[model samples]
Target: MTADRARGALAVLQDADGKFLCEVPCGYIVEPTASAYHIRRERARAQRRRRAMLRRRVALTVALLTVAALLAALMPWSGSGAADKPKDTTAGTLEEVHQPTAVLLPSSGTVAGYVPNAAEVEALAKLIYGEAGIVPSTTEQAAVVWCVLNRVDDPRFPDTVLEVIEAPYQFSGYDPEYPVKEEFAILAADVLTRYRAERDGEENVGRVLPAEYCFFTGDGRRNHFTTEWKSTDCFGWTLESQYTD
Candidate 1:
């Protein structure tokens, strides 16, 4: 019938089951309502807004989880540094940006290991002199030089000051067993001793060995080869000898 009749019939149908079937006709008419359309649109809009908010929440949660997982994976290999962003390597940790120690050793049997104090130098000098029968002198420090050199190569050598000096084949102190010059023998022993010390990663022994060439021929004379002959080869040092006895 009419919209008024349909609404009245619908209200009556709500109160009683199957009673309005007798009053209503079989033919139907759809009557649209502005209030109904407005309610439907509002419900749809509310649903859409709810769905959009849910999607945004899910996306934010996923992003946070991804960032947390990445941080967890990186933390093991990563050092002390910034957050999600990278930091400057120049502003590193204390261990990373550390300065090196500033102690030096010389072939003169002087603090020729990373020994920072004067006491260590004097003790090392005495040890070199006592074992190898060499006097630790300013001019004849080659034996100390040799000992320092060899010591750097191997730390397992005799740790005693004297033992380091007298270590076997450690220094070429034993030359042709002729009546040796007292002064020369002492100087040679000193050099051999120090050469051994320098080889074992001893920072003190660095740059202490003299750049000078000490050449000794079979003729018993201290020889000096020209720069042309000596410049290319440190093997020229083969002539340099350290006397053990």
Candidate 2:
């Protein structure tokens, strides 16, 4: 039966109408015994009554103990749910005990390392091509150039562009699959020489053919210079948009 219905039945048994029967059939219990049948019957009935009383007492005791246990388990043994979570009281408190107190610095450097020298730039360009094993396009070259410049200028990376490119653990340099190409090495040397000459105002010194910030391809065409750079109305060409993917 359901617990509720069983409890209802137990309640009925506790009523005055449910008082002990004061007697039980004894003959059935004493058929094999060699004694006064009526006396034996009386004793058996009394024993049955005693057993019923014990059973009821045990059940009541168990129910009471269970209720007590449940109450104990649910008491505010701790505090509220919020209290259970370690209160970050130290968050607003100036107390030193509560603070994490640990400080961190960039593993790379305060500013990205120096601009790549001619040899270093050549090594990096060749290394990347060797690792990627892909023919270097003007746009890809432009990307590396910009990444190097930005890295050198920014303190978040290695001190120099070449060092930033060669940052440890990020790129596996000696992997057989990533073979540095000879063409990249040649181009690296060429580009570095040209950049040096241009910086020195040696050739095409005054002409503004390409903006310095020109870094990527936007119109599905790589290394294509825009006519807007030639406009006299534009005193200076902004290379900022060159890195569009």
Candidate 3:
């Protein structure tokens, strides 16, 4: 068979319309099978693959973001907080510590006769805060309280601690309105206890200041740096806890 004859040849077909038909037998009942259909299918497959890749990228991004959020929540931000003042450090339990106060100076000799009560302790503590400004473990504060107690025993001053504190012009810083400070409160209480013990005949209870040497003043110095009196300066002021009187 020649190539041109084969292309031009046609097969005969019979129809059911009661007539003979003559036509080609090649299948072409509907659309033609061409390159366009294959192109469209390839484009659709490419779109589906792109969509799947986009979904994977979105899921990975979401997981990474979730992990970052969790890490942020779990991390502790140290070295970022409020600034505060140094808190006071007292040596004992609160009951032993935060208890109440005592004071006075007199023209004549005096000594404490009575045990200090809570109210007396409170008054004396305020007086010490007013005069001494409440330093930590400073005997200058105790000296201030001792001066007041020495007057408590003095017949020249009032008989009681409150009376001695309230006496006129004795303690220049004495503020009946002074705010109660914890340091002075404990100091006053401790001083009162020691004074009471010394009077009760207890020896060496750490009552360093002698009862006779009781008087603290901003003008006076401990051990009398310029004079024969005993003095010191814990409060940046000359404190003559021991004086001629």
Candidate 4:
């Protein structure tokens, strides 16, 4: 289109389908110069890096949420930490601690008495675990708890769960230095809750005993004890201790 056309010829290349491939003798074409190609390659690489960064952020978010969910599950039902003792829960009526299910026992029998001091339930649960091994069925542990309560009720035994449990050589395995498990504490809370409620004239459907019957041991061979009945009263077979007689 100019008088300088003779100096530089313009060319247009097309594919077999007649679609324009590119223009030649121009500064750029289908096969770009090395400098143009390097710029385009660097831009593509930056885009890939951005995409990878986004994927990492998504994965990190998902992991954080999973950890949060697990922590929530392990937290106490009353929303207190383990470092916070159940003994600290001395305010008014003790809140019920919900667990997955009731502490199952092998038998339901006569266990009654005035519940220990409202503040002593946590200690009572620790005492029960101390006497009963860690693996006893919920029913077995309940029997142990009831025995302590019976002692509290009996004019013959100590007036408190703490005193009864602390009595020399009774629990045999008790060591205050050992840690109390949260599970047993929870079960203890349940037992204490029922006992306190029933004693205060509240109807408790989850009550473990029909009445207050006392005495219990791994074997009936305790030397200085008396058996009230020739037959067992629901907790397999128990022999009452008669230290005075």
Per TM-score, the best of the predicted structures is: 3
TM-score of 1: 0.21
Best by lDDT: 3
Q: If scored against the real structure, what TM-score would every candidate get?
A: 0.21, 0.29, 0.42, 0.40
Poorest 10 consecutive residues by lDDT, candidate 3: 77-86
Q: What local lDDT score does residue 72 receive in model 1, on the 0 to 100 scale? A: 57
The residue ranges of model 3 lying beyond 4 angstroms of the native Cα positions read 1-116, 134-137, 219-245
| lDDT: worst 10-residue window of model 1 | 215-224
Q: Which prediction has more favorable TM-score, 2 or 4?
A: 4
Question: Model-by-model lDDT, in order?
Answer: 0.37, 0.38, 0.52, 0.48
Q: Name the lDDT value of residue 41 in candidate 4.
A: 77
Model 4: pairs clashing at backbone N, Cα or C within 3 Å: 105-139, 110-211, 111-211, 112-212
Clashes of each: 44, 14, 13, 4
Comparing 3 and 4 by lDDT, which wins? 3
Task: Give the local distance difference test score of model 3.
Answer: 0.52
Q: Compare candidates 1 and 4 on TM-score and give the better one.
A: 4
